[model samples]
Target: MDTIVYAIPVFMVMIVIEIVTTIIRKKDYYRLNDAINSLSAGMMSITSGIILKIVEVTIYTGIFSAVALMEFDSSELWVWLFAFVIYDFFYYWTHRMGHEVNILWAAHAVHHQSEEYNLTTALRQTSSRFILGWLFYIPMAIIGIPPLVFFTVGLINLLYQFWVHTRHIPKLGWYEHYFVTPSNHRVHHAKNRKYLDKNYGGVFIIWDRMFGTFQEEDEQYESIRYGTLKPLRSWNPVWANLHLYSDMWKDAKATKSWKEKLTLWFRKTGYRPADVAAPMKMPDIHGYQNYDPALSTSQQLYAGVQFFILLLGTTALMAVYHTTPTWFDALWIIVLGANLVMNGSILEKPEQAIKLECLRFSITASALAVTATLMPVASIFWLGLGSLAVLSLAYLRRYSSATEPTAAIES
Candidate 1:
């Protein structure tokens, strides 16, 4: 049982509170497209984790079973505390290396892609981190830490990092020295020359302090631009995960030497072969603008409603993925992924989004209708999906004309 499942409601409540607080303070911290895109990325990560986590746990458990150093008593308080602290220590290196290494940065960059620093930015995660991230925690298994203990501590460490994504929280005097606070974490998310790759702790700031990676949020520097040096200018969730890898592949193919092509991903972050490396101008930190595609009121409402529907679908998929049949689980995952892609497309290209939405809704409804007759699915499920499809199609049809071409936005 993932503890994060239980914390979803709490995460939503806190996000709402943060939004309200920012509104009351007149601080422009959140943007609709950015938040929705962040959450879409998060949904992709969680849904993909339904399968990825099993592989992670299996590997971790197998390692622990094979090399038993000395098992600690799981019931002991000290064991939990020690595991929690040690987990952060390992997380520090994992995070630090994520900045230094190119391939690792490709996965980690998803979290920092959002130009706006807010609660949703915390939810923004990479689905592909499981590719290499699991290697970082192998020492825990070697130390005979129980899988349950390791998992719980990891979740706790993750939960602790969420609140620190907010900008509303100011610097805490002495507390900032010990824990990963919003002030220090802001420095971590910053793309500024002085703040890049600093403060890599998950929960404790001490690891960064010890490793000489800590940098305070400097007041003298112009406002910290929150994003990668190479901006991910689109809101497409699938593209968000694939864009960096795609760039690397293109770089590898264009490189003159085979060794440079093979070793490109392992090179330092932002490394490119000289032949393919084009001199690119970095965005002026003081004048950087976030990626915000304009959408009419109707289009915004359509995207918002469709997003909420997909959110419910994602939540349901997360809840029942283990107990469901493999094919059914795969089907839901594909549909949900398609939903995310369509939602992002809607945001990026509103002119043609309604047609895409209608096509998606029609296909989904028709599939559900066919599946219900062939399987023992509950009547309520059919009714709910059927109603959603019908209503969504109607809504799209009603607003199809409003989303007409004005200016084409790049995706």
Candidate 2:
């Protein structure tokens, strides 16, 4: 919990520094509103992730943490250095299998489905990673990497990954040959035909080179697409993670042959009926696209400024919450319920006027979370009603953009 408690303040400082640095460098490509919405989703998803971490860290790492029984500072400097590489080796296989197997990909695919890549994309991780994720860490226990060492090194490894998600950094040349620099990591995130399944290294590039999965960035294939060929195309992060599962389940049930059913489940991601293979013909994103998403100029400017202020407010809320107040509970109950409903809403109409609706959502959610900070809730149940109302409105308004179809890009 100290991690959560201190993290708010620390992440606040970091985000402020990042935002200000972006402005100073004239590199603010994020639409302000989308940034806030994505940040809110990321924070909530991180909260979800930590809940699962409690299971992995306490339950699974409990095995290694019990290594306190073995008398040694096995977590010492040289020991930890070795453990990091071993952990990376385990991670490499697990990550490789995730690309090959459909079930595993469903969980991992959530991270790559974002069309926009940046610091936020790094945060756009899978909530279900905890499911198969412990398998990768299990090797640490066998190797006698103590629970303390296992936990600490795990955090360090994960933190090292955060910097690797950026397009801001170019190739570190020879550094790419040793460690998993941003250049190598960018290739890992690519949806391009040739780049897929390459650069599977976590912290070290040697893992990929040794495994024969390494590929250098190609100047000829200058374009890189961030999202999967078929995007989730929804604002709801929860559904974003589950949509592939839902599609796969539907496909598995619909298929006539047992082989086809198995193929539907494990062959590849976004696999579906021949009639529903929209992803196979999806438009290719050519040229340099990063940080910037699909919003227009006016909406981009508006959303970006709103994101700046709301992020400040979110950080402040975290800083101030010494005691979980009635309104805080109320706000969460309402927002989380609405968030789930938003997930179902997207799967229902993957092509909808979400950009317009998101502006409204950010305004309302910010108002509620902010108001709750000041006013104690009369009833948490009432927040549930508010969530329901908002969800219903989302349903009614989803496809109201007839002037321009949601799928059509209007500049």
Candidate 3:
């Protein structure tokens, strides 16, 4: 059974509850563009996992078969508990280094790009984290923890983290002393000097306290600023994943010293060569504001509608990926990813967003036509394509005007 899959409904319910609770308390912690962008990054992460997970499984299985020192049975409860604790120990180092090291942060920074701290922000995962994340769990394979046990425990740890991302949850008294609570995890996400690089534990706060990375929530000081040191201003999910890596590449190219160019990836997190000048002024955290772009009511509604449709399609793809044909699965992922890229563009209100949306729908229409012709059931696919075509035409007619004012929505 897929543990993450089973937890999806629970996560959705908790998110709805958080939204309602925040509304009741009159705290506006969410923006439409920010929430949608966060969720889009999450959906893209899952889609990318469909392929990248094979590499992880292959590497771990190969290493275990070749070099495992002991056989740990998954059927034993004690063995499962041991594996759980050990996995989190390694996860701590992986996560901590992700902040301190330059190359690893390139992939892990996507999760910290959101300025709003909400339930949706928990899902803002990095699609490129698979590049190095699998390496952190190899100790389990080396000690002969069964792959099934490792997978299940890791899923449980991740599900435990979902509840701690919200601002609605306060300090949980003694529970905060033992486990990772919303208070400490909130400190983990903050960019302030006091809170920076603290709370690296995944399942237990004990690790952070033991390792000296712990910091209690200081309410008297500055309010938490949720984002990276450098703001990712745009809403593009693909760019969100690649921006830091691209920055590293640009810095490396601009440097005069060959040794500096090669060592930059392995250096400390914010290191820059003397020869290469800083690009811009450091962001002012005290007077910082969330990146909320102006969009017309029509554009906002259009993005919301399309985002809902694409999210449904993504959920279906994830649920049945095992049984789905390879080509159809690839096509579905590509279309959904393209849909999100254009959605981000629309939210950012760029001049080319409308054109991108039109092109995306045009390609989707063609894909549906091909799917209808090839698949045994054609009516459903044709009906979907027709509805999409009509929606695209209406959107172009309504919002493609040059004189349309950039109106913004608060929610």
By lDDT, the best candidate is: 1
Tell me how candidate 2 scores on lDDT: 0.62
Instruction: Give a tens-digit lDDT track for model 2, residues 1-411.
Output: 334455555655655666676778797434443344456456555545433567787755666656434533673688888877787888888888888778889888877776655666666677787777687667567546777777777777877787777666788877988899878888888888788888887788898899899998875776666677666656566676688788788877876777777776667554565643444554555642432234444333333443443344334434444446655644653454354444334332334436434744674557465655454432232354365345546544633443222233421
Candidate topping TM-score: 1
Candidate 2 C-alpha RMSD relative to the actual structure:
6.9
Write the number of the candidate with greater TM-score, choosing between 1 and 2: 1
Model 1 C-alpha lDDT per residue in residues 279-308, reported as the tens digit of each score: 556668666566888787777777888787
Q: Rank the candidates by TM-score, best first.
A: 1, 3, 2
lDDT of 3: 0.83
Please report, in order, the local distance difference test score of every candidate based on alpha carbons: 0.84, 0.62, 0.83
Worst 10 residues of 3 by lDDT: 374-383
Candidate 1, superposed: residue stretches over 4 Å from native:
278-282, 366-384, 404-411
The segments of candidate 3 whose C-alpha lies over 4 angstroms from its true place after superposition are: 1-3, 278-282, 350-353, 373-387, 401-403, 407-411
TM-score computed on alpha carbons, candidate 2: 0.70
lDDT of 3 by residue, 306-374 (tens): 787677667766776776577776777787788898889878864566678668878777777766654
The TM-score of candidate 3 is 0.93
TM-scores for all candidates: the values are 0.94, 0.70, 0.93
Number of backbone collisions per candidate, in order?
Answer: 0, 3, 0
